[model samples]
Target: MVRLEKDLLGEREVPATVYYGIHTMRALENFPLTEYKVSPVLIKAIALIKKTAAEVNFELGYLTKEKGQAIAQAADEILNGQWQDQFVVDALQGGAGTSTNMNVNEVLANRAIELLGGQKGNYSLVHPLNDVNMHQSTNDVYPTALRIAAIWLLKPLSEGCAALQEALQAKEAAFAGVIKVGRTEMQDAVPIMLGQEFSAYAGAIARDRWRLHKVEERLRQAALGGTAIGTGINANKKYIFMVNDRVRQYAGIGLARAENMIDVIQNADVFVEVSGLLKALAVNLGKISHDLRLLSSGPRAGLRELRLPERQAGSSIMPGKVNPIIPEAVNQTAFHIMASDMAITMAAQSGQLELNAFMPLIAHHLLGSLKILTNAVHILDEFCVQGLTADEEHCRNLLENSQVSVTALVPHIGYDLASKVARRASEENITIRAAALALAVLPAEKLDAILDPRAMTRPGIAGTPK
Candidate 1:
């Protein structure tokens, strides 16, 4: 069935079976930029806003009890996962997210009209503009809904960081005694416990978790009541206060109206800040993943100091080969998030006065980064970190052969003597331990104590009294 709905442009045919009306139809025609729709998370958040707006309007006598009840009911159904398919506008639309807000308004207005025993598109009963979207503008509503969606996702991202931190800590404990050769600039440096490396990763994640927690405070101040340009034009001041409070109550988040509503509307610095935080997390994750892949490079020709779980075959042609698929996946996710941060940075600054038209771009990349970062943390924890093992004997062998291990005796002997021992070891093609013994740099017992894993890893000069 086809129904005609009128807009400023003229009347257009809308699919009668679907709740979305003329505005949405026009958006679909005008902005077919991508296959992606506005995130369902943002849609659900908008439903909360509309439901609260209706109840407040009814309380303030701006809407008839029946109209308000109908609108609220439609919004309730939407919040509970109804009519998701009716939100048909692409996420990449122009007009500063007006397409999204109008798409939502038209859907609820049509659904409410149906509830009131009126046919869909019969706006005379519950007009999308006059009733369902009473005193609201896309400039205010879209940004507010985006903030709420980001708030919802940030909590899980924080929790994901925490879980990953715990997994790294567990590895720290499990590998505390296993000494490995540390590398600097891709060259062997000195002895370090495998556990210490894991501990550093845990520390970085802990910082990321704290950062995610703190960034939410910036998002808590909203511009909900500041309709169009933050002047609250066409909206009752009392309704503004009431609606903002009610939305906060329904969301169960500590949201407050911005003291300078125009500032929130005009400046998108908070999202840039938040995106930067996410990028920091991505960098750390990328570094850790690359380190793991490098450490687990090969069972024969590579470092082979750490063992990652065998996932799929490394090569279709190579026989009996396994790959570090989990870390590789995490590395890609990190790269995408880093690029998203850059996109978010550009969009944030590209806005002009009064409002940012690039908000849809900001929302797309910011929300995508949050979701993928959270998933990456979880995958790294469950699939890679949990199953990781260290090749202690191989690590020990590498340390024994590495010339840098001779540096452990530098404080006891001297840098000059240490260099001589390293040079002699290289010339003779013998292990550092053998060269040290052959050179009689120190007593065997003393040299052994100096290079002990505990003495090397802990604070203090090895083979020397405190």
Candidate 2:
């Protein structure tokens, strides 16, 4: 069965059982863009905002005790994951999330009415705009909700990064004694411990974790009470003070009201800053994945220093082929994250005077990026990083064959003589040790001690034979 609901734009037939009413119905007709609905995290954030507003308005006597209690209870139910499907608006809607705000308001109002022994859409008993929304505006509530949602999403992303870091650190410890030839510009450069390479990956992820925490700190400052234009117009002063406190209590996060509400409302640079950090993390993950792909390139033809876990078949026709699918998947996720950052940047900069009309887009991309990145990091840790194995013999063979091992002899034989040794090794297609021996640069025992790949990976210059 359907019920008729009306507004200034006229009436529309909505399904009678839906908690959302006419406004959401109009939005559903309006923005038929992506099939993607608004994030449940965001919906919960908005519910918390509404719940907090109800509690605050009730405390200040702006709402009748019964109505406020009912509204708060309805919002709490939504927060606890009830009737999420009633929020039917597209994630990409216009009107600066007014559609989203209205969706939340309508759902809460109807649910509240139900609790009070009235039918849904009976706005006469408990209005969506009057009782449920109370003193809130989309301008303030929407952005505040976005901030809360971002913080909620970032916590897991941060934990995912830390877990990935720990996995890399474990690899670092496992590979500590494995010496390998390090490369620069895709050419062998010097000897380095395989552990050092993994350690650097761990350090990069550690920094990403730290940066995400910093971004969370900025996101925790919200603009909830600055209704419409940051002046808290049409809202009670006491309501403004107590609303954020109540929201903080409900969210269990360290959310505070923005000091300069106008700045928070007008500028979306905080999200831009967050996108930048996420992009940085994407770049780091991409680089690490690329290195993994290169190091684990081939079992027979390429730099087979590391063996990635064989997760799947590489080709349809090949009988026994396994590709580095995990790292490649991470690389693609990084690409999407970087592109989302660009979208977020454009949306953030496109904000006009007092309020950004592009908040829906911002919220969509920001939360989307965080969610994808968190999943990507977890996949990379579990599928790739944790299962990686170093080819100890391959590493030793590469170190033995590389002319760059002459780099360790530089201080002992002087730069000029080391250059001769490197040139002669390349010319004769011989190992640096063989070239040094043919040139009679040092006795065999001395050459053996000096050209040790393990010793070369450690600190301090080569000491003269004692």
Candidate 3:
């Protein structure tokens, strides 16, 4: 039996097939450089797919021992990381991962042939399609590999979010008693503890984490047995169950059979759901980055309540300047994820009756979102959060200058008098205490008691209830 390369050559010499031929070797040369190049995530996914496929073929019971062994050997080489060099297809392409699947088949088949003491592409002995890809279709395999990939990504993403939550929780605990001005529409309206603000960011991330996990659960329903459509038309019934079970075991994921294989085959809602989760994460990160930029704005003019780490030099000419480069990077990543989301939305919407057929874009965008969010979260946590400091002096100055102090006066001086004092404080650039003193709305000692920003920040003890 001769390999595809040997058959194409017609002699012992290897043939120069198209850069990335329909087979695995072509996939390698064609996709020699790509962001979608094989990752451990893809390796594990392909391993699961191949293992499941082999189990299915075995259950079909049509092949002899040698043929089954050939398929198994090729899959083992992949699982053992021997063919890492061959998986080069760009995941961003529109082939719906057909080239990627074929890459796996060709490389594995060629490796299997070598193991069997034959030249590569020896289809008569062990064909890539006949022996290796016995009962699988790209439609089923692509989505299944996606689920496997998502499962791989979910662990670190969740853990990274948890780490961020912990960092925020620590910030909350660290700043719990430290009061600062809380602004509405960029104007101070009330007082809240610095810790409360950090805790709120953490809470937002926590909820997003729960939402993403729920999204991942929807990803568990795969279209593996659906083949070209929901019918599983050419596949053996025993093959379906065996492959499903084996893939589940091999991947260590709880991928159950789809109840409506037609719906699974036709729709790309699962990708949509995952994309939505990623968008949520990106939105949250954007908000967090925006807040960081705002909080760290000025050591002289703006609200300098919080200080992010000085990631890089702020200006080319300005010495003693540090910029929030990490937060800026976070913002950019969020924008990229948002753009990816638009692609996912379009792909999801463009699906025809039977199949979306735009899954390549879905995978590309969703996977890009996952990768970006993961790395951004890491940078935010490691460089930004780890070195963050609350500017106690800035917090004090903000609270001291805040007209929100007059919130306590609403109980003692009444709404009308308090509004007058607040207006005076704002228009005249005077402290609310001084404004109250000038207005004779309250005595100096009484005004101090009623308008203390610290008391207002504490809650439930700012003033007597009127």
Q: Sort by lDDT, best first: what order?
A: 2, 1, 3
- Give the count of colliding residue pairs in each prediction: 0, 0, 7
Mark the regions of model 2 whose C-alpha exceeds 4 Å error after superposition. 464-466
Query: On a 0 to 1 TM-score scale, where does candidate 2 land against the true structure?
Result: 0.96
State how far residue 160 of model 3 sits from its true place (Å): 0.7
List CA RMSD, all candidates: 1.3, 1.6, 3.5
**Residue 327, candidate 2: alpha-carbon lDDT:** 88
Predicted structure 3, TM vs. truth: 0.90
Per-residue C-alpha lDDT of model 1 across residues 394-465, encoded as one tens digit per residue: 988887777767878888789999999989989999977788899998888988878775677778887788
Q: What is the Cα-based lDDT of residue 436 in candidate 2?
A: 92
lDDT of 3 by residue, 57-136 (tens): 76578666666776776777677766675666666554567777777776666666677887664557777777777777
Best-fitting candidate, scored by TM-score: 1
For each candidate, give its TM-score against the true structure.
0.97, 0.96, 0.90
Off by over 4 Å in 3: 1-40, 458-461
